[model samples]
Target: MRVRKIQLKTFKRFDDLTIDLGDEPRKIIVMVGPNGCGKSSVFDAFEEKQKDFRPWGGEDASFYSKAFFYTDETKKASTYNRNNSILIEFYPPNAQSSRKTFYIRTAYRFTSKLNVQTLSAMASIFETRDEPLSSIALDGRLDANYKRLLSASYSAFEAGDKTGNQVRAELIGSINVILEKILDIKISSLGNIMDRKGEFYFEKGNATNFPYSNLSAGEKEVVDIILDIIIKKNDYDNTVFCIDEPELHLNTSVQKKLLIEIEKLIPENCQLWVATHSIGFMKAAQDELKEKVQVLDFSEKDYFTGSHTITPIRTTRKNWQRIFKTALEDLTGLLSPRKIIYCEGRDQPRRDGTERGFDANVLNGIFSEKYPDVLFVSSGGNTELDQRSEIAISILSKVFDGLDILVLKDRDMASGKNTTAHDRDVYLKNNPSNHRVFVRWEIENYLFDKEVLKKYCNLNALTFDEASYDGFVVDIENQNIKDETGRIKNYCGIVSSINAEKFKQELAKVITPEMTVFAELESCIF
Candidate 1:
């Protein structure tokens, strides 16, 4: 089933939005936009329309569903429960069950474990419903998919007198075909069901007999979508297969291949709808499908007061530029950096609202003006940086040819060796030439240098207070407070409650060409 028209008013992030696909909509509808651009809300409208609707003390109307809208004027912003705001029109003009018309897979998709106690019957399409609106609702399909796979395989094996593996191959051979073609991997076996180890086993490269849980997040995503479609395609023949953020955890190359494979797997009568900011997927949909794909630029729509209509835009260079900006934002211009330094610490924020990528941010602030195109990334701790830096450099090199990537780490202060020339030589001899160690114990230690602190005090128009500063440094050295971040915070708390951001700014201001610390950093980074 294809959606011919959609009208939404006072929905999430949409005061009013309408999309009208004339008599025949394209086979594939790819909604491209930045995050929170009402793409997912459009899918929400479809799911909500299928719910069983019953107004207060009214009769049950299964085809009709309840939706929320602003009943108390646009200014008050008071939301009320109602069922009149959302309307979805099907091409066939017949009401179908939620499962029969719409097969939805939300963005948050993951399955940690699959332990099968007994085979469960698959829900009939007529009785099945759509997923909840919550994006964090995990896609618990792997376990159920496994049960269905086993049941189908067992039936085929018994009726046709086929071998266990052979019967299973018939059920999942198409899935394996796509997996092998895109990821260079295939399902080696469906582990023995009698032992309750019905998890999927895969074979890739030299690795064999690895459990389904061992697959990468991207690999698991591809497997989950392909397997589910293969098992349920017949039941949802004339359906609008909607996948929100299908490129989750997948790289650009994999996303392109996946889009092609998904289009092939969808039934001939069914239409595909996807909400994504994936450049690879969008490019593939346009270049490959051409007229068969409708590119709805959600980023261009007007989401203001009254009703507004939106139609597919031509995939022109201008249109593409806008989409790319929506997808990458500020990073669009820096897609290919002159140099990338993989340093220590996390790139993600901590739960307590602590700033992440501290090392990278500091380095960028110091060198941005001098080397404008150089990028600093916080890969992880020392060990993780050693491993992931190589992988990142390898993959990124393939994507952006001749990309200069390097690794940087802190000096090992656990040995109690002073920051001397001899120690620096020893560290360099043991590590790769591209992987350099800081002259200081860590990056933060540079901020607390006697000269840098004096410069900071002068810049802030405060007294030097050399006696107190020297005593604190001696105490820290005696106590062996290794965490330079904590040391900075402690000292700042005592003197003046300077936050990390302000501390970094003052530290950057003090790091000049005349300072010996500047010369040391230059030697290591350059």
Candidate 2:
């Protein structure tokens, strides 16, 4: 039900770019590039093209016939330029976008007069051209049909503690206070609390409110987006929101928050395409250890330990965001638990020696609809204890909300973290639950609270065998592995060789706010 692809031709630096929306899992698409490297140009190509597809603008131009790009030289405009031609192919995985994703072409001349006939030609693609603007529905419009003419036709505004121009760009001018949530920041304002009339105004030193006009140039960029979107609100209808260079004027943190939110705001049925040069924006979409961009992260050796990097888009041919679609999940309805099960790769050999496809049967029993998937739990997918443990903990926290759960943490036997039979017996006795190696704990009771762990200190922390942990390092002798050493040792390639059941045993030890440790997993037998 969502758009799955964006194809480009003759659009700026992307002489050609075809991006896949990843299979099964719907992921956030990130287009990365350096400034003036045509990242924004590619975005404009799509946005401008879509404009022509609309019946308005009275088309003197073919949506595909327009272009707006820098001249061949960095500082000079192209002296002998042609209307930049562009095409955007938007197709959804399901039957939803079948030939439905908007395609547009347009022509731009800052000095040219309006061409009604061209506009009419572009408009004809969506129903009859004779229809008036008020009467014509934008539901079927394509893009290039309008690309070049409306340079900044749309805008996004940002909210929260995010300041400066860049963060503000994410805010598509909304009068709604939801901005507070987007910025994750509190701004100073002098507004009155007018509850009855649904109004709030600026008052110095209030909750982080500022006048739109007074903000700096970068901050105004966000306001500009707000105004643009507000003026062209109708564009969202069956829209494909292609946002390029989202970090244009924002700080790293705000850039990330805004980018993260943009994916959520688009209508689930609507398509979203984004490109960025900032690593902050891509962090959520990229592999955690900088592991994905292995070669590029050569400068710092310590980045393996959750260190941050300012991602550089040095190569024009490389596509950074396009590669990480696997991590994308339409995080829009995160509050609702759409059942997902992350088990061991069904075919890959598991360290637990469990047979292939064993996870499927266990998962089927745990989530059967007759059982109504009441637990709405998931597998902590992987063969390694730590990665599996982390996956189990993360996905459950991110996706589940007040649901019963079953997490099958492998009883890792190869590592010291492995739960011995004695440890397993103790865990079983303490939690009093059983499902072979898999079991449940109520959300209220076992959501892995850091504060709780600090207080009670009863849960089994992830302790490695002193020898194995030491040998792993001593064996390497702090040699050339440098930056990659720590990460290589931590990834699933290494972890999967360890325990499968140890994780389950350890997770069973945490205490929930009210329920006993394993009550939820044990009660599922009914």
Candidate 3:
């Protein structure tokens, strides 16, 4: 049922490779590697040689026949004896009829839009064709599975023992439980077969009676894998369940959840072997399963040159970083931020010609060249930032190890701080290190400093109209415009009525260390 050892020669993508699982293998084995790295070839070898390996049911002895596929035409001169295997004294050498040992689902798993006219008896699991490892063909099983479900209900109806809902509960209730938890939708009804409307319908929110085809590709994949496992558990109870790239079409978070749910459905006696390059799935295996899992890094050994053996790698930070490098390549840098500052603003841009993330964009524009690896994220208004920053930091810490996550708040009028920028600590007095507050009223207030705007005019060869700029600032302060953003917009309109966005951008561009506002802002941020 579980793999102890595997050997392959002249197999697809492998000339000679051996995978040893030691005396007692872990229940969950994750094969991690990049594309074209022989991960799928291991699955192919298992499929071709499955008949020679018998299920281990706590028997003192087990048997395995060596499997090989010669690539060169001349090498095929020697006939391969299918029944030949190295003999050990664990059990009787007399061979028994081959039994099912590997239950595999390839990466090309997909279901078409399905509708059934009549309920038919479902075929046994043994009767189903094992798809070749390379074929990209769709797996048309959802409709057939639906028929089997209806037939089970019809059989229970004829027996007159349980209601229709009860039969469904026995067949697909568990699958619905997982689906509801993941997608917030469940099977509303198995359509009426006699009415010539046999289809699987789903309900999400108040919407009801949607066909199977309406589901997203990721949703269908989730249902397909979980439903297949649930339906075949009785027949494939003690077999090695192999799913290749279970993360296909699913996002990172959903991939993690699906892997966990799939592990729950796999019988305790059976082992789960997953061949994947998904960070989410690998992370779930490492974090959630803990010591119960083993990760075989296929990227470590060069299988093409000659003979080689692979074993599970240690789950350390360095090894995980290498795995991420292999999996994501150049994209790995995007996720690895040395420092992150959460500031107050909305990051999303609206249809109107207004610039968003005024706080975050200004900080990034000013500090990006100085600290290239630091990231500034817009975390909404001050109140929302106060509520969500802690939870967000806790999560980011787990995702990116050793990341410096901090929060920066605006010094609004409510703070009752001195408006003059003489002696204000960037870090809050209550909590010094992680939580910081700006010295000015807000980011926009810093943008509107009279000295900063005068430098902007001087740099651009325009007239230094300090008198008009000061008049606008003085008028806004006299009006007591509490909203800093609206007050800045009014000042921009007075200066450049035609294009306030360009004016703000140009003024931010002119801000440098020469200006007092720039020095004050730099001192707080750095």
Best by lDDT: 1
Candidate number with the higher TM-score (1 or 2): 1
Worst 10 residues of 1 by lDDT: 54-63
Compared with the true structure, model 2 gives a TM-score of: 0.36
Tens digit per residue, CA lDDT, model 2, 1-526: 3444445443444434444444431334444433344344444444444444452442232222212253434533323122234433344433433222432211110111112222222332244342212211132121222221222222222233455443333332332343453443232321221322111122233434443334444343333333223323345446555544445567766666665555445555564545555656665444231221211222222221222332333221112323222123233232233333334434453698443454343333323322322222233343443355455556666655644333344333223353554664565566423223433221212322223223233333332333433444342211222233233324212354434333322333333324433344434333
- TM-score leaderboard ranking: 3, 1, 2
**Model 1: lDDT of residue 171:** 67
lDDT of each: 0.72, 0.36, 0.68
User: For all candidates, what are the clash counts?
Assistant: 2, 82, 1
lDDT of 1: 0.72
Q: What TM-score, to 2 decimals, does candidate 1 have?
A: 0.58
Tens digit of lDDT per residue, candidate 1, span 1-526?
7888888766655666789877888889999987767788777666665444311221222212222333554344334433566767877667454546777788877876666767767775354332334444566776777777878887888887898777777766867888886797899888886887778989989999798889988998888898888878888888898999999899998999999988998977789999999978976875666657887887875554567888887554446557778888865653346588989878676698444787887787676544545778887787788898889877888888667889987775334555565777786898777878776667756767767767776776666667655676773212333445445444433365556556665677668767887777888889
2 or 3, greater by TM-score: 3
How far residue 410's Cα lies from its native spot in candidate 1, in Å, is 63
Candidate with more favorable, higher lDDT: 1 or 3 = 1
Per-residue lDDT of candidate 3, residues 385-412 (tens digit): 8667788777878888788888887766
TM-score to true structure, per model: 0.58, 0.36, 0.58
Candidate 3: residue 380 Cα off by (Å): 36
